[model samples]
Target: MTTDGVEAVFLETHNWGKAAKFFQALGFDLEFSTDHNSGQLRNGDGPYVFIAEIPEDREPGVQIVLKVTDADAFRPDPAVEVVTPFEDTHFGTREMTVRDPDGRLWSLQAPAKK
Candidate 1:
């Protein structure tokens, strides 16, 4: 299936506060913050950025979230590796994970069906 393009960037950081402040300094406005030390930020009309705090021992990384209008209708190409099927996310969306040829993980996100 085809994606509508990146919807957001998911970032893992060791320090949530510092990460948030850094993005704010880049002119991105905080859209909302979760009690669990994660938040969404936006700049202009581009894709929003979602940053979450990970344990200090964990390596921080970034993943691009591709937008799918309908998850149920998504069909990966034969060469694509589907790591996880679409599942409801706590933040209110349906998400699926896939592994690229290089072993990098990418997320596909679709609006929660009403």
Candidate 2:
């Protein structure tokens, strides 16, 4: 299947408030927050920003969540690195991860099965 578009931006931040403020300054409105820490923000036309508290074992970074027509159908060249095979995630979506030439990780997601 073909990729639809960008779905969201998964961000790891040390301070949620600071990150939210930074994105807000860039014009993303607060979408929703679980407690005062994690939340989704949007710039009206969608392609949301999902800000999460960085875990001890995880480094602070940003991951692009791409909307794909089918997560299982996304395949790159054989030389590309696959961080994860497509699988059902806890957040209710089928997702997979692949690393680019520069070592940037990208996640391709499809709607969860019923």
Candidate 3:
């Protein structure tokens, strides 16, 4: 299926404080901070950024979130490997995970069904 476009960037960091500060320096304003050492940031009308803390032993990485206007209508191509089906998120959206041919994971986000 066709996706709207890139919606946000998900980042994993060992040091939440430093990572937040780094993105803030790049002109991203913190939209909201969760008690769980993570937060969402935005620069303007563009896609936002989400940073979450991971264990020190884990390597930091970034993943892109693709926007889907209608999760129920999404029918990905047969070649796409859907690692996880769309599920409601604590943060309010419905999200799905997919692995690329190269084995990289990506996230697809759509508004929760009413």
Per-model clash counts, in order, read: 0, 0, 0
Tell me which residue pairs clash in candidate 2: none
Q: Which prediction has more favorable TM-score, 1 or 2? A: 1
Q: How many backbone clashes does candidate 2 have?
A: 0
Measured by TM-score, how close is model 3 to the native structure? 0.90
Tens-digit per-residue lDDT, 1-114, candidate 3? 689999999999998899999999999999998998999999999999999999989899998999999999999998999999999998899999999999998999999999
Determine the C-alpha RMSD for candidate 3 after optimal superposition of all C-alphas. Answer: 1.3
- Runs in model 2 deviating more than 4 A are 55-59, 72-81
lDDT of 1 by residue, 1-111 (tens): 688998999899999999999999999999999999999999999999999999989999998999999998999888989999999998799999999999998999999
State the C-alpha lDDT per candidate: 0.94, 0.85, 0.94
**Candidate structures ordered by lDDT, highest first:** 3, 1, 2
**Which consecutive 10 residues in model 1 have the weakest lDDT in total?**
71-80
Q: Check candidate 3 and list the clashing pairs.
A: none
TM-score of each: 0.91, 0.78, 0.90
User: Candidate 2 residues 38-59, lDDT tens each?
Assistant: 9999998979999998766878
